[model samples]
Target: MMLEDLYRLLRSGHVQAQGVVDTITQPIIVLDQNLCVVTANNAFIKTFKADRDDIQGRVFFELGNGQWDIESLRQLIGGIIPRAAAVIGYEVKHDFPVIGQRTFLVDARRLVHPDDNSANILVLFEDVTERQRHDAEMDFIVSETRHRMKNLFAVVRSIAMQTETKGRTAADYRDTFLGRLDVTLRAQEISVSNTPADFEALLRQSVNPLGAERFHCTGPSVQLSNSRIMPVSMIFHELATNAAKYGALSGQDGEVHVTWSLEDGPRGRVFLRCEWREENGPAVTMPEHKGYGTELIQATCAHVGGMVELKFHPEGLNAVIKFPV
Candidate 1:
């Protein structure tokens, strides 16, 4: 082709290339062999908050007050671009004046001009802030859930020891211990089948035998881990039992209110605070000695790193339990 025809062809290619780069949604920049920014797409300017005039033709490392001059990144691109097809999934964390600390996955490839054999680097950036945040939250939840499960298992071990002390023989111990174990296992199964157990559903199941009308349960829709379900259900069971035998649930007009709320606690940690308040019941007196039921409730609460306060008020019985969420 003639020189004029070749120039026209190159000019057409440049226009087509610019149109392609401009259409990309991800931040993209073209850099020369010396790491000088040859051109940047619209997405690049918008994403990094840079002007076309300020970035185009400038050294990439000097852009944005040298924010792009990452040492490890420079080494990565310098070493990989020449020998390999591309350097893919290179992570870069930068704090821009316009945007706070952000994470980006960068891909760089060598773009060669066939006519002159001159080469440039085409770099693409994908923002992964939301993905990283979601992964971190999921990891935390899994870890905490595992810790809670371990604590619950420890509580079961303690319960076995306590129950063993009251048994007359091996057979008696087996019967009593297994009976309590069965309750825990059943609760565990229920919770496992429905992971992140619904607070309202668990409460309803625990007090269903005592008659739902005897208890008024009100709380926000909160989900608790499987480990949390058994201990909490047991506490509710104990409360319902005591209510039916001696507290509010004993009388025809008596009632019990079980309300809970999630609130910020000390040091900015969040916790769930639940209250079991009885009303219009037979007068109650504080027990001098802690029974198995009381001990079980206290032990379970302590195992989960929680606090329980029980008050034998003249009007009725009130118990409050609070634990981290």
Candidate 2:
């Protein structure tokens, strides 16, 4: 019903007005020209955890430890309502005594009784805390999706540029590039999926094709965040590829041992430390220059706030990768 109709009912009689106001679901209050509470709806009493007897005839600002004494609300009631006759959707955020934090869209309307020259202000409260939180969550999801897409594109471009095409035919180049792309896409899929990606599972998947017997892996269970998954997956893929080509996996008697642990770093930061050690491999020596694989590994590690250290000992190739979890 209109504010005028409600006001007319309220002016008619207190007993009848109480019944009518109680029917409304939204919390409402009627205040005299002096800002004293004339009557409050049952919804208002329930919503604010107030007693009707205590609120009636009390000043609005003095009620409930001065919670209602907000400066903006004072302005809306004293200054704006007098001139505008109505103030719609005046939002207020406050920590109420019993309700904790809440957001409300307040609508105030000035009411007049023509016969008696009486004036009162009608205030309506709409709880909008949940709606605001949902809106914020949607905005975050949209921003996160855009950011992930941009990063995915950049990663694809870098991988394409770094994939070596020299000393390879068109088919070989296509296979090599596509293999890396597949690994990247798989990582992206896992990162965006509803289920969290397991670090050990990811490592195993990257090196599983080389025969499980050629490698031994052990690590405590670790779950990776969405932002870290792609880069970590790429690091694992590169390390496995390099091992299969030039390290332990290249020889029949060689074996690779992968182990990882979580450690507390300086300043209480937790870090993931992984070691890739090869044994019984052909004599190893440091390359004269860094190859695309090595660069890719280093770049991916740096992308995730991590570092990779490679050691080409005479016996085998050893790598230590460290990054914040």
The lDDT leader among the candidates is 2
Candidate 2 structure quality by residue, lDDT tens digits, 195-288 = 7788888888888887578889999999877788777877878788877888888888989899999999877888999999998978887876
Number of colliding residue pairs in model 1:
0
lDDT of each: 0.83, 0.85
The numbered model that scores best in TM-score is 2
What clash count does candidate 2 reach? 0
lDDT by residue (1-325, candidate 1, tens digit) is 8999999999999899789889989999988888899989899999888989988789888999998789878877776456746778988887877877999999988876567455788889999988999999999999999998998899689768777355257886676577567667779788758668888887887778777977898899988887788888877877776788778888888899989999998888778899999998888888766756677778788888888999989889899999776
Candidate 2 runs further than 4 Å off: 1-20, 79-84, 112-118, 167-170, 185-203, 210-291, 294-325
- Per-candidate TM equals 0.54, 0.63
Any runs in candidate 1 off by more than 4 Å, and if so which?
Answer: 1-15, 79-86, 113-116, 164-325
